[model samples]
Target: MTSKFDHTVYTLRRARLASQLGAQGVAIIPTAPEQQRNRDSNFLYRHDSYFYYLTGFTEPNATLIIFADGRTVLFCQPKDVEREIWDGYRLGPESAVQVLGVTNAYSNVLIDTEMPKFLENIPTLWYPFSIHKGLSVQIDNWLTVVQSKVRSGVSAPHRLNDVCSLIDEMRLIKDSHEIELMRTAGRISANAHIRAMQFCSTNIRNKNQIFEYHLDAELLYEFRRCGSEFPAYSSIVASGSNACVLHYRADKASINDGELVLIDAGCEYSSYAGDITRTFPANGRFSRAQRALYDVVLESQYAAVSSTRSGALFTDPHNAALRVLCKGLLDLGILKADKCGSVDDVIANKDYFPFYMHRTSHWLGMDVHDCGAYSEPNSLAQNSAPSPRVLRTGMVLTIEPGLYIRPSADVPVEYHNMGIRIEDDALVGDSACELLTRDVPVDPIEIENLMN
Candidate 1:
C-alpha cells in the first residue's frame, strides 16, 4: 500500500540524518526479518521502526544504507514472477529509486558483496545497537572485509555509534505529518473502545455468557474496520479480579454481570500507535464500589493530564497523579492515616506502591513505548545533577493513571479486587496538553448513557 505521508517526508528525514552524520559516518538500517511461526508459515511481517522512519518501506529482507553526503542506497528483494505468484508483489530494486526517492537501489542478494564497499573509508559506522539480533556480527563481518584491504589503504570505520541515539531524539518530536497520523489513530482506538463497551453491555443484558475473548474480538474487529493495520500491542481484556494483573491478556474466563472489565487496547495506523485504556461495568450500570474506585482513578488521570504541558518536567504528571491517588486512597480507607501517615507522607514513603505502582505517563509514537530518552541529555553537560526531561511542543505521551487493589486485610472490603485505569493520549502544547483519545467518554454518566 502507498504511504500516508508524501514521499518527500521520508526524503527529508534521510537528508536530516545524513546532515547529522556529516562527512565521516555511514549508517546502516535493516528492516525486520520475518519470524517463523512453526514449520513453513511466518508471522505477519512488520518493518523496523527506524528503517521505516527513514525509508517507509514495508517489505521484508530490506536494508537501507545512508551516507553523510545525503545519498541513500536501498537493498531490497528482486522481482521474481514465481515468488510473486506464490507470496505477493515485490517493489523490486529498480522501481524503488523512483518510487521511494532514494539515491540508488539494488537487490538484497548483493548485500554480502556490496556492504564492504559502503563501509570502506568511513571513519564511523552508525547503526542501532542491541535492538536487532545478530546485527552486530553482520556489521563486524562487513568491517572485517574492509580491514583485509589494509595494504591498498582502504580503512574501515574504527568507531561504532548507535544511530538510535540520533533517531530517537528526532522521533520524540512529532512533525505535522506524524501529529495528524497519531490523532487519527487515537480516534480509531477510541471508537474501538466504544464498540467493545456497547457490545459487552448488550450481551450481558441479553443473559448471554460473556467471556474476555468476546470483548477482545470486538476490539480487534473495530480496529481493522477503522482501517488500522494492527493493534498497537496485545489487547488487554481483564475482567473482575483479573484486572489486578497489570499485563493480563484476554482469556477464556467468564465475565460476571456485576464485575468491571478493563480494556487497555489501541490501534496502529500508518506506523503510528494510539494507546487507550478504559474500565467499565460488565453490566449497563456500575456498582457503588466500582464507581467509587473508578472515580478516584479518573481524577488521578485528570491531574496527570493537567500536568502535561510544554516547559513542564516529564515526571510532573506522575507526581501530580500520585498526590491525587494518595488522597483518594486515604479518604476511601484503603490506607489508614495512622499507618501510612498523611497523603504527602504516603507519597514520600511510597506506601501507595501496593495500590498504584506504574508511572502516570509514557511516550507514545511509532512503537507503543516509543524510542526516546527519558532524561534530558543536555542536563549532564550543565554540570548539575541529572534532571527529568522537559516536556516540549510536538511531544506526545500517554497519561495513564491506574489503581490496582488486590485483596488485603488492611484495605476496605469494598476496595479489594478492584483495578481501574484511565488513560488518554496527550500532545504537549505551549501552555497545556491536548487529549487525543477523548472520543471515548471517561465520565461515568456518559459511559452509562453510551452503553444504554
Candidate 2:
C-alpha cells in the first residue's frame, strides 16, 4: 500500500539528484535481494535504504534508473497471480510507474535484454559497486554488452562512476515528510522502551528481571503492538556488569538491585529507523556509584545533543562529548591523572578506550547507521579534510555516548562493573535542532518515577 509520503519522497530525491547531476549521467539503484534463511525459510525482507529513499517501493528484485536528463524508470516484478498467492502482493510494473510517478516501468525479466537499449544514448553511467557486488557485476556485463553494440559509427558512454556518493550527499538532508515519518518511528520506539521499563518494574526477581531474552522479547512485543514489524537491529538488553560490553547481545544475567541495565533498541517504520539507547537502575533506583556514572553519561549526551546544529562539523559533538567524558572519568579515578600528560593528551591517546569506545554519533535514517560521508579530505594537508563534513538542516542523527567498566580485578576498583549509555535521535534544523526521541525520559528522577 502506497502512502502519500511515498510519492513526495520519490520526487524530492529525484529532484535533488537531477539538480546535482545536471544532464550528464544516469543513476541506477537496485533493491536488496531475497536471501534464504535456511532450507525453505527466508529472512524477513528489508529494502535497500537508498532504493527505498528514492522510490519507496518495498518489493524485492527491483531496480530504479534515473537518466541524467531527469527521466526516471522503474524495473520491477510484474504482477503474477501465482507468485502473489505464494508470497504476498506486488506493486506490479504498471502501477509502479503510474502510482510512483516514474517516467517508465518494465518487468525485471527484461532487464538483461533491455538495459542496453535504455543506455543507448546516455553519456555516463552511475551505479554503486561497494554494497551490491552482484549487481555491480551485472552492470559491468550490461555495460560490456552496450559497448559491443557500438557500431564503428556509434558512440557509447565513456564515463562510469559510483552514484553512491551522489545519492548519499542528497540524503544528508531530510525533507519535512521524511522528518515526520522519523518522528512517528521515534515515538513508537520510545513507547517500546517504556514498555520494557514497565516490564522491568514488575519482574524484580533475579532471574525474571535480568533475563536478557525476556527483556528483549518484551521490547519486541511493544514494537509489534505499536505497528513496528521488527526492531531496527538486534535489541541489546545488557544488564549489570554485562552492560560493560559495548555490543553485548548475550543478554543472560541475573538482575541485582545495585546494578544498571542498558537497553539499546529501535524500531523501523517504513524504511526509516529510530535508534535510541537508555540506561536505568534495574531495581528502579540507582545506587550512588551507578547514579554517578549515569549522570556523567547523561551529561555527555546532553552536551553532545546541544552541540548539534546546522553548519557544525559532524565530529564536533564527539569531540565535545569526549572532553566531558574524560573529565568525568578522571574525577571518578578511572583514568589516572598522572598516566596521561594532560586531558588533551589523554583524549588524543584515546586512553579512555578502556571504558568509553565508539563515536558519539552517526547518521540515522533508513539504516540505523545510515549512508553518508562523515569527511572528505581537503587537498592542502596530505590527509586533512574539510574539518569533517558539516551538519546541515534536514539531517537526522543519533547522539549516543556511553561508558563501560567491567568487573575485573585489573580495573580500577571504584569504577568496576558499571555501564551507562544515553542516546537520542535529533534532527538538524535550519536554526537549531529537534530531538525526535525526546519522549523517553533520560533524567534519573523521571526514569525512577516511571519505573515506580
Candidate 3:
C-alpha cells in the first residue's frame, strides 16, 4: 500500500537539524534489516521507529544521511523487475530523491564506495552503531578506514554519541498530524478491546468454552482489519490466575466461567503505538470480590491520569497511583495494617510488588515503550532517587495501575486468583490531561453494562 506522508514535513525536519549541526558533521540513519523467520521465510518487516519518525519510508535496506551543510540524501534499493514481481514495489534511488524531496540519492550498492568520501571532510558522523550485525561490521570498516588515515593527519571526531536522545526529545511533542494519527490508532485499539469484551460475554456462556489464544487471535484480526500493520506488542490475553503472571503471553488456557480476563493489547499505526489494557469478568458480571479489586485498579489509574499535566514531575503520577493502590489493598484486607509501616512506608518498602509489578506510566509514541528521559534535576524517581527532568505539554504517556493476586490458602481467600488492570493513554495538556482512550469503559458498572 502507498504511504500517507507529507514529504515536505520530513524535509523541513531534516533541514531543522542539518542547520543546527552546521558544517562539521552529519546524522546518518539506516532502516532495519530483514531477518529470517525460519529457513527461506522472512519475518514481516517493520521499520525502525526512529527511522520512520524522521522519514516515513518503510522499505528495507535503506539509509538516510543529513549533512551538516543542510543536505539530505537517501540511499535505497535499485529497481529490479524480477525482485519487484516477487516481493512488491521498490522506491528505487532516483525516484526516492525526486518523490521524497531528498537533496541526493544513491543505490545501496554504492554506499560502501561513497561513504568514505562523504566522511573525509566531515568531522563527526551520527549513526546508530551495533544494532544490526551487518551494520555494525559496516561501521567497523568505516571507522577502521578513518583511523588508518589518521596517522596521515586525517582527523575524525573523537567522540561517538547515539542520536536516540536528540530524536526522542524531538518526538516528545506531537505535531497536529502525529496527534491525529495516534488518536485514530487509539480509537481502533479501544474498539478491539470492546470487541473482545463482547465476545467473552457470549463465548463464556458455554462452560466447556474457548482458550485465551483464540481470543487473542480474534483481537489481532480486529486490529489488522482496522488497518493496523501490526500489534504494538504481543497481546497479553491472561485468563484466570494466569493474569497474575505479568507479561504472560501464553494464551492457550481455557477461560473459566467466573474468572476475569486481563487483556493488554494495542495497535501500531504507521510507527506510533496505542496501548490499552482492560480487565473484565469472562461471565459478563463482576463478582463482589472482582468488583472490589477492579475498582481499586481503576481508581489508581484515574488518579495517575489526573496527575499528568504540564510542569508536573514524572514521578508524581506513579507516587499518587501507588498510594491509591496501597490504601485500597489495605481497606480490602488484602494487606495487613501493621505488617508494614505507613502507606508511604509500605510503598517505599516495595512490598506491593508481589501483587503490582510494573510502573504506572511510560512515554508513548513511535515505539510502544517509547524513548525519552523521564527525569529532571530535583525530581524524584518513581521507586528510586530524584530524576533530572520534568513533564511538559504535548508529551503522551500511559497511566496503568494493576493488582494481581495468586490464590493461596494463607492469603485473603476472597481476593485470591484475581488480576485487574486499567490502562489509558493520555496527553499532557496545558492545564490538564486528555484521555486518548476514554471511549473504553473502566468503571465496573460501565464495563458490566457494556458487556451485558
- The candidate scoring highest on TM-score is 1
Segments of candidate 2 deviating more than 4 angstroms: 2-6, 22-24, 205-210, 376-386, 408-414
Extract clashing residue pairs from model 1.
none
Predictions in order: lDDT: 0.92, 0.83, 0.82
Best by lDDT: 1
Candidate 2 structure quality by residue, lDDT tens digits, 1-452 = 64553486587678678666645678888999888899999999988888888887788999998876678889999999999999999888888867888989999999999887777767888887688858768887887877887884445677777788788876777877778889999999999889888788668733453577778888788888888867899888888778877888836676666577889999988777899999988788888888888888888888888889998888988988998998888887777787765679888898888788799999998889988877753432356544577888888889999998966664567668778899999899776789999789999999999998
Model 1 misplaced regions, further than 4 Å? 3-5, 380-385
TM-scores of all candidate predictions against the true structure: 0.98, 0.94, 0.94
lDDT of 1 by residue, 384-417 (tens): 8889999999999999999999998888898788
**Candidate 1: lDDT of 186?**
98
* Residue pairs clashing, model 3: 213-251, 375-388, 375-389, 376-387, 376-388, 376-389, 377-388, 379-387
lDDT of 3 by residue, 1-452 (tens): 26654587777777776775645777888988898999999999988777777778889998988888888888899999999999999999878876787989999999987876677657667776555567657876777777778878787655565666567677888877789889988988999898888888888775547889877887888889989989999999999898888889846898888989999999998777899999999989998888888888888887888888998987888888999999988888777777875677778898787788888889999888888777752344255775645778888989988998987665689888888888899988987899888778888888888888
lDDT score, candidate 1: 0.92
Task: State the displacement of the C-alpha of residue 364, model 3, in Å, after optimal TM-score superposition.
Answer: 1.1
